[model samples]
Structures are given as C-alpha cells and as structure tokens.
Target chain A: MIIGKVSGAMHSTINHTFYDERKTLVVDKLNPDGSLTGDYLIAIDTVGAGAGETVLVIDEGNSARQIVKEDNAPIRSIIIGIIDEVYVKI
Target chain B: MIIGKVSGAMHSTINHTFYDERKTLVVDKLNPDGSLTGDYLIAIDTVGAGAGETVLVIDEGNSARQIVKEDNAPIRSIIIGIIDEVYVKI
Candidate 1:
C-alpha cells in the first residue's frame, strides 16, 4: 500500500476498455514521515477522492482487478480509501 | 514493470513460508533517465541478479505469484529479468 495525495487527474482518448468509466488520478507518493517524495504514480480511484486528498492506494494487481471487477484488466494501483489522518510516533 | 537496480540483499529467519528458499533483494527504482530515486523496495529475485545489476521488476501481485508458482503468495514484487541495456529517446 502507498500513502499518497491526489495531485491531479488524467484523461485518455484511446485506452483500455476497463478504464472507460473510471477516474484515474496522478498521486504523489509520500514518505514514511508524511512528506512528499516528489515521485508520483497513476492510480485508479475507487472512493471519490479529489485533488489534495490523502488516500490509501493498493498497488497490487489482484486487488486492483478485484475492485475494478475485471480479472484480466492490465492494471495495478487503486485508491482503496481516503486517509483522514496519520500520526508518527517519535 | 519497474526499471531498477539491485542495491543489496536481505535475509530474514522469521518470514512468510513462501519466502523460505527465495532471495529478496533491495532494488532502487530508476527514473526514465536511469537515475536512481533513492527509494528502495524489496523484491523476490527469479533471475540470479547481483548487486549493482540493472533489472526489470514486475510489481504486480498476480505476476509475482505466477513466477513463484503460488496462487496465494503475499508477494507483489519480483525481479523478472536482468536488464542488458536501456535507451531513452530524446
């Protein structure tokens, strides 16, 4: 799982059939300390996550396929839930 | 697929049963220009990859389980092949 923040959205004119009705977002991965690492990954959103919202992303193929309801979809990374808060023990 | 370089290897006595005879290596993901991002992930190696060798990593659960011959292994990263070379078009 990746703790990331939704940075932006993406759109494709010619793409796979599974992504026809899904919203793909550009998510910036956060470090363990909750700081942005400046690296990003594209993830299919399940929960209604908007820009700047922290989310939980499952970067596993089976999990993504199960949520998208397609076993053969060539996809990994799905926003499973929205993260409300994170606390790091010092 | 993730283009990464093997940084080092890891050993854990108490781990999952599926990892008993497998070799897990620390891989540093590379950017499109082949520069290391400094972040690392542990992956089970299929090919005999050594430290400092560039490799291709499949970070999908289904693919990892397929290579390990287990349908339910809790794995997502696998070093599928040792990369020979990479070229980026300008």
Candidate 2:
C-alpha cells in the first residue's frame, strides 16, 4: 500500500472493458511525510476519491483485481481508501 | 509490464515459503530506447537471467504467481523473458 494524493482524472473513449463504469485517477506519489516525489501512476478509483484527496493505493494486481471483483482484468493500481489522517511514529 | 535489466541478485536467510528456491534480482528500469530511468525494483526471476541481461517483467501479481505455479504467492514483479532486441519504431 502507498499513501498518495489524487492529482487529476483521466478519460478515454475506447477503454478496457474493466474500466467501463469506473473512474480513473492520476495519483502523485507522496513520501512518508507527505512530500511529492514527482512520480505518478494511473489508478482505477474504487473509493470515491476526489481531486486533492489523500488516498491509500494498492499497487498489487491480485489484490486490486479481487477488490474490483474482476477475475481477469487488465488492471493493476487501484485506490482502495481515502485517507483522513496519517500518523508518523517518530 | 515493464522492460528492465537485471543489475544484481538478493539473498535472504529468513525467506518466505514461496521464495524458498527462487532467486531475487535487482532490476533497473529502462525506457523504450533502452535509457536508464534511475528507477529500480525487486523481482523474482523465473527465467535464467544473468546480470546485464535485458528482461521482460510482468508486474501483475496474479499472472506472476500463475507462472511460478503458486496460487497464493506474495509476489508481484517477475522476470518472464530475456529480451533479445528491442525495436523502437519512432
């Protein structure tokens, strides 16, 4: 799991069948203390995460497919939860 | 899926059951033109890939596990094929 921020959304006319009714989000990777790393990935949004919201992203394909209930979907990254707070134990 | 080159190998004493007889490799990411991206990842190697060999990697956990014949392996990145050549049609 990774803590990331939703930067934007994406749209495509001819998308994979799995993404038919799902929203795609552009997520910028964040460090533990919430600093941008300049790395981003396209993820299918399961949680209703809006732009500027911190989210919990699962990059594992198996877990992601299981979450979406798709047996053989060409999908990987997925936003599983919207984060309210992040605690860094120091 | 990604194109990468094996940079090094890893050894762990206390290993996961699924990785008992598997070899872990450190791979550096490559662009379409074979340029180093300064990003790397750890992957379990299925093919007999040596260091400096460009390989095809499947980052999908389910597909990787299926290749290794493990139904519930906690793995994602896997080296599936060694690249002979990459023709970039640009």
The lDDT of each candidate is: 0.74, 0.74
Docking class of 1: incorrect
Residue B73, candidate 1: alpha-carbon lDDT:
91
User: Which residue runs does candidate 2 get wrong by more than 4 Å?
Assistant: B1-90
Candidate 2 lDDT score at position A62: 78
Write down the DockQ of candidate 1: 0.06
Task: Please write out the lDDT profile of model 2 over residues A1-90, one tens digit for every residue.
Answer: 888888765443332345556676667778889998766666778878888889999877778779888776646788999998888995
Which segments of model 1 are wrong by more than 4 Å?
Answer: A1-90
Angstrom error at residue A15, model 1: 26
Residue A82 local lDDT, model 2: 93
